[model samples]
Target: MSLLADNGKTSNCRPAFVCLLLFSLLQLPRPQYNLPFSVLALFLCGVVSLSLGQNDKAQRDRLIACLASLILVTALLQAMLGFVQALGLAPQTYGWVLFTPGASDVMGNFGQRNQLAQFLGWGAVSAAYLYATGRMGRAATGSAVLVLALMMSWTGARLPLAYGLGLALLAWFWHRRVPQDETVARMARVLAWSVLALALIQIFNQQIDSVLQAIGLPIHVQSGSDRLLDAGFGARRRIEWSKAWEVFLQHPWFGVGLGGYAWHSAWLEAYGGWPKVPESWLFTHSHNLIFQLLAETGLVGTLLVVGGLLCCLLPYFRRGEQTVDNLLLISIAMMLLGHSMFEYPLWYLPFLLMLVIICTLSPAKGWTVQLSGRFRQVLGVSAGVLALAYAATGILPYRQLIQNFTPRNENTLQASLDNAKRSLKLSELSRNPLWSWEADLGMVNYLQPDGIMRDLQLELAERVARYQPFPTVLIKLSILRALNGQAEPAKQALTMAIANYPDYTPVFQHELARYREPELKPLQEMASKAVKAGAAQGGATEAGRLAAVMTVAAPATRQPIF
Candidate 1:
């Protein structure tokens, strides 16, 4: 279907939009605390309105420009911050911004350096498109590319740096394609500036890095080898993706329900004979977008998501003159695709929203038909009322969960649980791995250890495992399993726990040491070796590449990190 706006009546627009909304809505926004569902809803509404031809061509172009500018500005500011950090001028972030910083990295406005890199990549490309088209000035646009590229380099964000350079080189070819009536000299000038900017960006890491070292200037917080990077058996993301694949295999048809990525990882760590994470950087979604889609939504859901994206994108590939907007969309699409391959860019509301806007912005045939007259009045009123109700009721639990952290008073504690339960309902019967898991942890904390109900403990244990493979919770589960007389399962659980953690708690060590189960001794040894094997596989001299090595240790621990 033609995607550009026109005077027209369209039926397909409704279905494609509905599918887009479905794919987005099922994602469950609470997992990313910074990207709440309300934000997604609002952005969805705007995209739908535009798609339904509520806005004209002029308005559409303006919106696109505005969005590009917004992305560029945010990236520019982030790069500026990174430069300052590189110069050892920025302050360290200890507390939470979104995902609490575990180490000193140039995280920019984002809590993670990787996320900021994703945004910087988009910004660099956007600037390139604007400069090549002469829609924006060479100096300003060139500086943006230079600064963002430099930041991406310094932060060790390899993909963004690579993407920026690749696209900058591609932009050179576009310079000859510009209309002669327009400033051709302008294209050449911008091309030269961009090349210079990219070159500087490429060397910023090595040159400035050496300088910082030689001067011995105290840098802003140094995140010496990160916990998420250091704590996992292999590369953290590979292990997380492997767990996601395992989840898909178990429930290949319908999958393990929506918003279930973290839970599956928890289960993998628990029953799969891998130990739980001690750190907070939980893999809430599969780092690989396709794998996450398959694990969370199953086959049908994955199909729907893929189909919906095609519906939006296929229209753009048709022959058309290379316009500024087209270039911008192409650049944005590549960057988004790059991040989604190895990062959860779709979970970031702003990125998703930007994508929806970009993918939907194209010319269409026929007369634009907007809802109007008395029918429009009724429709508008109904939409407002439903929006208000949803905002008030559906989001109430998310708000409560964010506000109420930990509570000791019985009423307050119950209220928090109630809120989380309510959130689960609004979350399409799913739980936010981070916040929802916190509520569950709080519940376990409040229960009396001696009098805790076995069934309730088991239920909580299973649910917690689904969300996060927290060692404390898993230990508690194993203890409960033992108390309930599930001797074999309990032994297996303890073995896996020991396998995961090289340095476990004293309580866990004592319990394992004291266990008399002769059957479990071999299993414990297998689990231990599995952990060591994963470490050895990741121990190769190569820097940062996830090794394709898989050990022949016990199946429980030998699964390749995806």
Candidate 2:
């Protein structure tokens, strides 16, 4: 119900009031009080974890061990999937999985190589923890760790290997400090196995492709493996980090707003002269949690979060002895924490939930909150029910939208249009209504007459731009303006796209080249001039380098602008 108050304005409630104050201090626009789905997940998971934390140590350990076993098993399965993909044997479109799983893209159902690698790293940690606690045999733990380590290497993400090395050293220290503890000794052995796997993979990566070729596998592992050879961090990450820093400087005290980085980054590229990322690349997060928080929440939110983390750690730091159990738990949680420094694994619900649970299990040095059993039950049930209810609210609209937008026979056009209307109406109940624009666009294009279609599309495009401001939105707006006999506005919009996405000049040319419509001739001419101007600047190759990181295949619109 609190989320219902987010109508693009600050609410009088405590959380909303705090958000309003933060936005005011940051000099950003009036804050929206909408609660994103992640917030609810975080709340519910925290409730569950805190409740678990209050349990007896034996009960808690049993639960933790079970959770760790689940993590290890999940990771092992994903690792096997990744290995299949790398071997060029994965079937396309298996069940819910999409994407061409070839050697260059070993996603393991996560849809991203980096994310797959990080999750596998977490699994490796779990396997170690399980072995150290005598829950798993040494042989099984060793096999799981080896497979996970090998798959992580094949994913071509260097950060996990680097993180593994650092943690391996820490494990060694723990083993040395507590030489008598078999748990520490076993964990150190697992860490050593991971390090050895990393080293073995590095040495044999170049030859593995040749051997695969000998076996007639169509794909070679060379593409992703080559990334491992380079020591420098990616250029795209550097540019993103740099832009995030500039945003921090602009609003250092507060921030643009929570979840504002992507839109603000788009706005900056279009009008604020910020260095543009690759075409179609929207930086949802800065790729670094610290930088993202600094850019989104600024110093105030950063301090609050960091200070809270420190307070949690202060208990461990002040302890007279750092027990191996505590260190092991911290190490397991550190898998996600270290990954957050390089990637946004926590953005995914499973990883975030796991992190919350692990942190809850970790012993914090502080006064304990001794809630009565009845109180704990009430709190957990209330939070879980609220989260479940909020989640269910989106299901109907999402289903309707999916059904409404599915490709249908021309005979069912009227039915599709009717369903689109119903879907849009249902979507109003959603806190995030941006998705309704798709149905609106579909209805406008199909139901509206030719005489008004262009005008309605223009209006819709403009409205979307107000919220999104992506380059494609600007280009679509330009195309619509040209189609509507407003050439100047069209050119202005095209100019904005050119300025923000010069690397996309090739894409613009490709799209505009199909402009057989007489009214769109000016748009084609403008694109040509922009291309030539970009080439004349002697930066074509330089611009192309960034585009190599990520480029859109084409515009996202269903109907071609031409």
Using all chains and alpha carbons, the TM-scores for the candidates as numbered come to 0.69, 0.76
lDDT at 527, model 1: 38
The lDDT for every candidate, in the order shown, is 0.56, 0.62
Q: lDDT (0-100) at residue 553 of candidate 1?
A: 10
State candidate 2's TM-score. 0.76
Worst 10 residues of 2 by lDDT: 1-10
Q: Write the per-residue lDDT of candidate 2 for residues 1-562, one digit (tens) a residue.
A: 1122112222112222223223334433434233243344545555655455554467666776777787788888888777677765666536544347333467888988878887787787778888888888988888888888778877877677676677777787676677888877887788778777766875687686677678887545543346756644455566566667778999998776666777556544444543444454455676777788788878987776555555444453333334545555566566777778777887788876766555555555323433455655566677877777767875875676656553343658797776556545533533355345455434333322134557766776776555455556767777777778888877767766665576776676776676666777887876777666556655466555334322322222221111
The residue-by-residue lDDT of candidate 1 on 1-562, one tens digit each, is 2223233343234334556656556555433332344435644554554444444566766776666777788888887766555554454444322222344467776767777877877776667556655568866876776777666665655565445555565454444465452433353455356446655645544455566677885443322121224444345577677778788888786576555676566446545644233223345776788788788777877888787667666555454534556656766776787778778777776777666666556443323344333443344456667667766764755555554434334558787685556434434322544345456655554333234466876777766665555556555666666666677666555544443343443345454444455533543444345445445555322210111111211234474554
